[model samples]
Structure formats: structure tokens, C-alpha cells
Target: MKNLYFLALLIGFNLSAQELPNLNLLNLEGKSVSLKNDFMEKDKIYVFSFWATWCGPCINELEEMNELQEEWKKEINIEIIAVSIDDSRTQKRVKPLVKGKEWNYNVLLDTNQDFKRAMSIVNPPYTIVVKNGKIVHIQNGYVPGNEKDLYEKIKTL
Candidate 1:
């Protein structure tokens, strides 16, 4: 009985230890914000989606995420922040393109790629699920129906 109780406690600690790490990044307004400070306080889940204007897959994911934003928010307090990894030369196109698409979620520009380096993301449409400021899951590349799995993950959290 004593060994069983100790084993249960160890398992519980191990499960909690799998929580995500806290990393800071800039918002669309160019303001630095700690990921934990922004997403963890209310115990809500947030999605940090890295993207670029020229990437077709990234664009598709953003569009789908936009369409499902309202529904997802209703079910869970999820914030899908689309971070544009456009370089200085292409950065000028971001605003116009985003404005044209009429995407409603929070958008940020990663002109210097600092955020990308911090996250160690090498591709566009890289999505990370953050809960209470910790990264719980990461997915690289995007597919047409990937948002469904994302929503399921968020719902369970």
C-alpha cells in the first residue's frame, strides 16, 4: 500500500512536469510581451501560429483559423496569434495583405525573426499550443483539416 501511494504521487508529478516552457515575443504592435503573462493568467489556451505572407500553406491555415475563431473562442478562451515571419523587404506587404484578407485574430510581425529563433521554428504555419504560459504541443506544417485536431486539443484543455 505504501509503495502504491508513492508510485501514484510520482506519476502525478511527472504528468505536471510535461507542461510547456515560457517564451516572450513581440505583439503586432511591436510591444514585447511574455508568453506566460499574456496567456497563462486566466488558465486559458492560446495558439501561436508562425506564418508568412508568401507561404500558401500558411495563408490557408490562417484563413481557416479566422473562420473558426469565433466558434473556438466560444468553446474555449483561445487566442490564435498569427506571427508573420516576413523579412524587411517583404514586410511592407504584410499589412496590406492582412487588411485585404480581413482576418480578425491578433497579428504580429516578426521582421527580425527573433521569435522564430526563440521557438526554433524552421517552417511556416508552425503552430504551438500554449496553456497557462507553457507550450504543450507543437505542429509543423498545415493541412486543410488540421484545425479540427487543434480545436479538439484546445477543447480538452
Candidate 2:
């Protein structure tokens, strides 16, 4: 039974890789946004990093990505959309936190966590490198130097 479940999960992930899941996550302004359907660009690669206000490691990873924002845009047409998986209890804190951090990102809210489960995201700091309507790479967690590696992977794809 465990093996069967694993197999099904694998197939689900494969399908997710081939096509972006249609999810109705809300932006910081409470407007519904779909990463693929609403924000598609001609050749832009999107990095969707799932995080929460309380996740320390998640904040670290996002900060690292923030530092490289200029270089990434200068080199490639890319956008990093930070998706907050904070529930309703803490959702109200998102705006102030973002402002305090000065993270110039299209901060989206996954207040219900629907997108996370639908995309099979297990935890915070999970990143999906997407391009041309498909997932190019996925990074589950991060270390201090992982941002450099992320940039290199984006360069190849």
C-alpha cells in the first residue's frame, strides 16, 4: 500500500512538472492570482518560493534570492513570486512584514494552503523554477550558498 501511494505521488509530481497547476491563490492585496494563467510572459522564468512569516529558514532563503534580484533580472527575464502559506490567524501580518523586509516581490497569499497541497509542497522554502509553462527545476530546502546554485541552474534552463 505504501509503494502504491508512492507511485501515485510520483505520477502526480510528473504531471505537475509538465504543466503548472491551476491554483487560485490571492495576492497581498487579496486579489486572486494564477501563476501560470495570469502571470505568463513571453520568455520569463518564474521562481515561486513558498514561505511563511514564522519560518526562519524560509526567510533566509528569500533574503538570499532578494540580494540577487538585480543580477537575475539584468541577465534573464525572470520574476520571483514569493507565496506565503500563512494561515488566516497570521495572514494579517504579511503586509507589514513584507514592507519591513523591503522585499520587492509580488507577494501572494496562500492563506488556505490549497496551492501547497495541490502542488505537493511538503514544507516552507520549497522553490519551483518554472519556464514556458512547465517546471524546469525544484529546490526543496536551502543553505547559505544554495542561492548561487539556484542561479546556475536557472542559467542552464
Computed on alpha carbons, the lDDT of every model, listed in order, comes to: 0.80, 0.87
TM-scores, all models, native as reference? 0.80, 0.88
Residue-level lDDT tens digits of model 1 in 15-92: 445444455656656688765566665677778889998999999999999999998888787788888899999988
Please give, for residues 2-21, the per-residue lDDT of candidate 2 as tens digits: 99999999986886577677
Off by over 4 Å in 2: 1-16
Q: Lowest lDDT 10-mer window, candidate 2?
A: 12-21
Q: Give each prediction's root-mean-square deviation over alpha carbons.
A: 5.6, 3.4
For residue 14, give model 2's deviation from the true position in Å. Answer: 1.9
Q: Would you give me the overall lDDT of model 2?
A: 0.87
As for candidate 1, its clashing pairs are 20-135
